[model samples]
Target: MTKCRECGKILPQEQRIDICLDCSRKKIQKRFRDDPELKDVFKKTIEELRKPENVKKMAEDTYRIVNAINEMRDGR
Candidate 1:
């Protein structure tokens, strides 16, 4: 058994998602409905992170995403 990261719900082994299922599903739907480009950016960033030669670029991409999210939050 494990606790969900987002909701802190205790779940059986099979039910344990990286985040709670509810949170994960909500995030998935949100990604599809709004800011779909972020989904692609996350995928590409993960792929880049997996490659040793692209690690620096991965960090740069992550920073860009973080800044973009922050800007959106700040209504900039």
Candidate 2:
């Protein structure tokens, strides 16, 4: 048996999802529907971040962060 990643349930190899089936349907499908406030906030944040100047800044920041991770992995 392997542990389900989301709900920490013990399941047989052939029967396991990252989350159990019940959680999969109820949580993944309906969770966003249940959180209108969070969805609006997420939408507003993404719209702000998608401006041309902000997009470039975000890309540069992500590149620098990934470079730092690779350096650590390579012991540099």
Candidate 3:
């Protein structure tokens, strides 16, 4: 079994990546936090995502996606 390089977590048999998803996510977040430019961009992006208009749009999009999945499952 493959193991995560950073956390030593055993990876699934078919997983091709060296690191587990959780550890990779943490590493990416740490990089964004440590880099000043990336930190600012990430902060701004999060702020934009939190805006009411964006939140509403995201919710609507999620609903549409779920409905689409349901339709597909129902053979529509």
Top candidate, metric lDDT: 1
TM-score ranking, high to low: 3, 1, 2
Report the C-alpha lDDT of model 3 over 1-76, residue by residue, as the tens digit. Answer: 8887779989777665666656644654655555445456445655765778776444334334334444544773
How high a TM-score does candidate 3 get? 0.46
lDDT of 3: 0.56
**Model 2: CA > 4 A from native:** 31-76
Q: What is the lDDT, from 0 to 100, of the residue 25 in candidate 1?
A: 48
The list of candidate 1 runs beyond 4 A from truth reads 36-76
| 10 residues in a row with least lDDT, candidate 2 | 59-68
**Ten residues in sequence with the least summed lDDT for candidate 1:** 56-65
TM-score for each of the candidates: 0.38, 0.32, 0.46
Deviation (Å) of 29 in candidate 3: 0.8
Question: Which pairs of residues collide in model 2?
Answer: none
Clashing pairs in 3: none
Off by over 4 Å in 3: 39-76
